[model samples]
Target chain A: MYLHHHPFCPHSRFVRLLLAEYGLEPELVEERVWERRPGFLALNPSGETPVIVEEMAASVPGAFIIAEYLDETRGLALGTHRLLPEDPAGRVEVRRLTQWFNEKMYVESTEPLVRERIHKRYMSREQGGGSPDATSLRMARANLRYHLKYIGWLAKARKWLAGERLSQADLAAAAHLSVADYLGDVPWDEDEHARDWYARIKSRPTFRALLTESIPGMPPSKTYADLDF
Target chain B: MYLHHHPFCPHSRFVRLLLAEYGLEPELVEERVWERRPGFLALNPSGETPVIVEEMAASVPGAFIIAEYLDETRGLALGTHRLLPEDPAGRVEVRRLTQWFNEKMYVESTEPLVRERIHKRYMSREQGGGSPDATSLRMARANLRYHLKYIGWLAKARKWLAGERLSQADLAAAAHLSVADYLGDVPWDEDEHARDWYARIKSRPTFRALLTESIPGMPPSKTYADLDF
Candidate 1:
């Protein structure tokens, strides 16, 4: 299998973590989505990443779809490391939290902050990529705190975000937080339980590849790769 | 089952359509999300619509989660109305299209149009909703056409939006378009194939409830409920 992705995109990173957790190492190709390269668009008309081309020549796009695809195909092979719970209700909770991060946290926090702090540097001025807008960044930061508190609340109520076992919900939350952490945006000290929960996820072997990814001219924060932090 | 929803919210409507298709009738309770009702927030801290209280006493929130929950629990009982395909690849395709409508189409078209044309009337002047912004509506309309063309393209390529059999992808597409149609925003003449696909979905018994719903002081367009249209 081969995967096309952007280094800083949370969704892309989510898929990478899932792949690593499944113990499958697909060839990774970095995609510059803003350029809308015709080749990439041909592979996935939505012009987004990460797009996974299976050995059977099937092209799977969108992070949520890819995660489900991987689970359905290879999750059982792992024996007990399945990213989704087998029961219907447990699956519902995992998917709910997954969508919560993928859509809610993304729209309200991750997307705006990343676009402002990271993507703007790579984009042309005509594409609205100059200095980051202070107002937007401030709004996103404000939104981030509420999400962190919610994470803390969930952490206190359940062993994992969705239940007793690790699931896509944990991966999804970690994926978004990792990107924000790279930019030094996550105020980890604000919520101790949330930070502790994240620490557990951060130390996992699957997360090692993500922590070391450095974008050109946009290095991650000094503490980004530190497991102790 | 009980569902708290808003008549104009596409996600809410999507859940309703799924329930109807599954032959499960959930008692409906309209939620004014903009008001941020304390009771509703307790049920779902996100304060979003389409929260389902199942017979098992689980509060299944979010449209995607609820759809999967219903499918997993009751899909087998029906034998043929499964919203997700059995195979992994087909499921990925179905989910990809579902996300395409839920996120991409929503961000580009539905949310903006609905907020401007419908939500604005319900909001107080202090809440920033007196009149519709002409620019937003125009941009949403332009984006709508591209999405409609994409839908048309997909419809022509497959028996249903995702594949040979109808799935959540078709319902998702129809759900968003149904809302747009309610406001007379969809130019059905732009794509005959897309229109025909929608007509087939619109004529289903499950859609009858949605067609008869009349939002106070905001009547649906003349052609909105006409299946023959």
Candidate 2:
């Protein structure tokens, strides 16, 4: 299995955490998808990532096709802790939150930060000299607190944001936060449960590779990798 | 079971499609959630529509939650047509496509159109707008084409959007396009596959309720519900 990802991408990080937690490490090849070409675009025409490739028949579907393939082929669901619930009602909650964090949180919170704080430097349009807009960062900073408050409410109610089990919800949240933490944007002290929950997840062995992630000219905070954070 | 929904809500329509496809009907109660003083908000602090109330639970999750409940409790998944594929890999593709339509396409495409073409009198300053901006709508319009183009490509490649099997991908895509069709936002003539697919799904008995939806100040195009169009 080959996973095409960008090093600092929250979506990739989210998928990586899942791979780590599940103890399945695929070979990772980083792709700068924004620097698009015909070959890479064909992998995901939408030009998004953490695209995982499984050697399925050509007729099969793609990214998600690979996930379902991986989950079933590896018998990942056979574990005592299932990523998705078997009970239909509970599974809905799992899937919804999995998407909630992936879509809503990504849109409302992480994407803004990445665009304002990170993308300009890498993309050719705003390559050099001009600083990433402080105003956009401030807007993201303002919007982020409300999002944390929302997540805090969820963490307060359930053992996990989605439900009683640690599922994709945790991975999704961690992925965004890990990327933000790389940029040093998350205010972990603001929400105790969210902070504590994230810390617990990061301390696990699977998170080690994520903690070791480093970007040039940008630095992780002193506590970025600390299990105690 | 009682479902709390508003007719124009895309999420509500998504669940409605599931109910229609399965030939299972749940009692519906309309709630003007924003006007409720701390009541409905307590049930779902996020305060989105398409919430379900089973016999015991205070507020069941959301549309995704209720749809799965019906699919399981009523054995709605038993039909010759399956929303999710039989295999896990195929199932994930359906789920991913479902979110792709709902989360991305909705935000990028339908939202701005709805706000511009509708949402003015029925909306408030606090509901994120009192007036829809034309600039945003223009951008949304451009983005909608790209989204449609992507879907057209996938539809062209597979017998169904997700795979050879007709699954939740169709329902998810249909859910949004049906709403757009009701408002007449979709340019049905844009692409052959998109038009053909839209017509096939709209013809289903499940789409009957959506075609009949009436908003307080706005009316749908005369042919909004016509399968022949």
Candidate 3:
């Protein structure tokens, strides 16, 4: 299997973490999605990153679908670390929290900050890339605090984000937060419990690849790679 | 079970369809999400609609999560009409298409069009509701055509949107299109195959309630309730 992704994309990073947890190592290819390369567009007409080509040569697009696919296939093979729970109710909670971070938090926080801080520096002028917009950055920061509080509230109530066992919910939240942390945008000091929960997830072996990924023009924050952080 | 929703919200409509398919009828309550009523906010902090309070009184939020919950808990009882395919690859395809309609089509077409046409009239002057934005409507119309063409391409290629049997993918797509159709916004003539596929879905008994729903000052289109359309 081969994975086409952008190093800094949170969705791509989410898929990577899920793959590592499932014990499958796919060949990685970096894709410049903003450029809309014809080859990549042929694979995914939506022009998004984190498209994976299976061994049978079929392309699978979107992070959520890829994560579910891995859990259904490779997850069954491993017989451990199921990203989703067996019970219907458990699955619902996990999926809810997963969407919470991936959809709501992403649209409200991650995308705006990442677009301004990272993508803007690399994109061409015609693509609306220039100096970062101060308003967008400020809005993203404000949104981040609200999200962190919610995460803290969930952490206080459950062993994991969704429940007792680790699931894709944790991975999804970590994926988005990790990207924000790379830019030093996450205010870890604001919520101690949320920070502690993140610390536990950050220490996992599945997160190693993501921690070490270095973008060409923009480097990760000082403590991004520190497990003790 | 009790479902809090709005008449034209696609996500709320998506959950309603899923419930009908699963043989569950939750008492429906219309919510004006823009108003941000405190009581509704307590049920879902995000203040989004389609929050279903189960018989046990647990609040299940989000369309995707609620659908999965119903499928997991009740799918075993009926022992037929599984909205998600059992096979891993087939499940991936179904989920991929589901997200395609729910996320891609929604952001690109439905939300913008609905906000401009319907929601804007209901909103107050201070809340930025007055006249429709011509540019937004035009962009949404153009985006809708592209999405319809994609749907047509998929309909022509597969037995259903996801595969052989009808799945949540079909329902999710229909839910979004139905809302647009209510506004007389869908250009059915542009895509013959997609129109035919929609006609089949629209004829389902599960769609009966949605067709008869009337929103006071904003009734459905002339052909909205016609199965023969």
- Write one digit per residue (lDDT tens) for candidate 2, span A118-172: 6667777634324577777787777777777777888889888888888777777
Sorting all predicted structures by TM-score, with the top scorer first, yields 1, 3, 2
Please give, for residues B7-91, the per-residue lDDT of candidate 1 as tens digits.
8899998898898888889999998798999989988878898899967666888877777777778878767668897888888
Candidate with more favorable, higher lDDT: 2 or 3: 3
In model 1, the Cα lDDT at residue A136 comes to: 92
Please provide TM-scores, in order, for all candidate models, with all chains considered together: 0.95, 0.85, 0.93
What DockQ would candidate 1 receive versus the native complex? 0.71
Model 2: colliding residue pairs: B83-B168
- DockQ of every candidate: 0.71, 0.34, 0.60
lDDT order, best first, reads: 1, 3, 2
Q: Write the per-residue lDDT of candidate 1 for residues A167-198, one digit (tens) a residue.
A: 99999999999999998888988998999899
Off by over 4 Å in 1: none
Tell me, by TM-score, which candidate is best.
Answer: 1
Candidate 3, residue A44: the lDDT equals 85
Candidate 2, after superposition: displacement of residue B96 in Å? 3.7
